[model samples]
Target: MNVPAPAHLLSLATASPSHSMRQDEVLEAATQLFDGRFPQFERMAPVFKHAGVLTRQLAMPVEWYLQPRTWPERSAVYDEVALDLFCEAARRALDEAGLTGAEIDVIVTVSSTGLSTPSLQARAIARMGFRPDAAGIPVFGLGCAGGATGLGLAARLATAQPGCRVLLVCVELCSVAFRMEDFSKVDIISTAIFGDGAAACVLSTGADGFAAVAGYAEHTWPDTLDIMGWRVRPDGLAVVLARALPPFVRKEIRLAMERMLASQGLTVEDVDRFICHPGGMKVIEAIEGAFGLGQGALDRERDVLADHGNMSSPTVLFALDRIRQAGLPRRSVVTAMGPGFTTSTVTLAA
Candidate 1:
């Protein structure tokens, strides 16, 4: 198969809800909410302290999550916040790219935390003034990897249609998935780290930006579907996080990275920088170990986690924005893991 010319990443932007929660405040809230309810609340509460998250933005106020909410109520909030964030992020991205929504030939929206009928781009079309004929692709279920995956998709689309621009947006309202009724450890851990945010980027075949999509690949482990995902409950979506995540990353991520880079006749040594999803402190460390880097080599990843928490799909894009601001290297690798027990890697060139 012939490879299309790499698509340029013209601009990237991120947005978060107004309400922000400090780590100490989150610990206090978790204690008040889960202390007596969960059997091992005391034993597991410490996870919040070590989550490496200093603060996070929430779609709703912290007090709003204290009350039990039905799925309908949660869905309503998701629709409202998701649209607002998508529009803000998209508009900023378009402005930075010196283009309007109407100039976009394709729109790729990725999310997994909530359900929406018209999809994010569809809902934002009239508000953002995108052309009615623009193609819309809504990708769900990629979980944390959605941002990188969506970027790869948009790049491919732009390459396919030369001179066309593609807009990719990732929005996750992970905070709205909080379950008061579920006393599982996953729920507690998720509450400690998950946040609400959205990120958008413009991609085109033009060479206006510093970064271009070079290559993309993914790896999914068999029989690992239960590792990380949601458990549908009558009240809302419950968190399901398996304990094997860190070890799995250490074991498989390197090999996956080698394969992805080798396909382009490159190797880990050829990568000048690694822009990765900061799943947590431990996950960042694991990635460093996988890449044979120093313990704190992934400072940007840690910084993004500390500032924004884990906003699922949009977290990696936040890291990319920071990397760009610092100054893009000649070659960078963007990777993220998500619910399918899947790892998505995208090689970018400056």
Candidate 2:
């Protein structure tokens, strides 16, 4: 059987909003907001300090999250901030690829934190100036798995078109979901780790590039819709982070990962490197457990979590970008778990 040619990744890049907050800063802000309001906040306050995060990037300043925000206001902020990060990341990726927006034939944007009508691709036209006939694909609700899934989708598109340049952008303003009205453990935890950022990559069937897309696969668990996602509220979106998540990852992720790898006709032994979304410190630990790696084995994953917190969908790409910068191994597997209780997996090679 003749194997198909692999799509090549020309370049990868990441971006973050300007408002950087230290973990102590976030902790103090959370204390000010939740100290007297929520009875259990004081007891749960340590979650912020122990989140394995040193700093995070937010589109808005910390004080903005202290006040109540209506859905309309949040939606507007999402549009402005998300588009800015998208353009920045996309430009860097294009530049690193030694190409331009006019050279891009397809654009795939993925996000779940907020909605954008006419999509970010259309909104980015004034800044990017792409060809009029360029394809635009805006995917929503993939949540944290979006980066890996977008990479896979762009690679497949590149494979199909052969010479067409495909740009994949994953942008998420996860900080917008911060809700002051709600004070549950889930709310507190979300405040402790969630941040805003974007990641982008340029791909095509080009012989000269950093890495080639080896394969892609994913598996969504059954009856697991509530595992992790956003819950719409009167004011804005809220987090639906189940307390069972870490345990679930430890219990089930390995078998599912094995199954997905099998779909690509590979095994754990075949992968030389692993890139996973840094959902939080605990989730990173859980991912380590699932893969049978030692603590701190996935240092890039930990570094992204510490520096940027969890930017959801773009997070895995942040980690992948770090790996690419440090230097890639012979083979690598990038994956993330999100709303589908899904594991989006993509393989890359030098």
What are the per-model numbers of colliding residue pairs?
A: 0, 0
Residues 231-348 of candidate 2: C-alpha lDDT, one tens digit per residue: 8889888889899999999999999989999998999889998899889888889989888898899899999999999999899999988888899999999999889889899999
- Model 1 C-alpha lDDT per residue in residues 1-350, reported as the tens digit of each score: 97567799999999999999999999998899888888899999889889999999999998898999999999999999999999999999999999998898899999999999988889998999999899999999999989878888888899998888999999999999888885887888888888889999999986568688888888787899989988888988887888888988988899888887898899899999999999988889988998899999999989999999999999999999999999989999888999888888888988
User: Candidate 2, which segments miss by more than 4 Å at Cα?
Assistant: none
TM-score for model 2? 0.98
Q: lDDT of model 1 at residue 295?
A: 97
- Clashing residue pairs in candidate 1 are none
C-alpha lDDT of candidate 1 relative to the true structure: 0.90
CA error at residue 23 for candidate 2, angstroms = 0.6
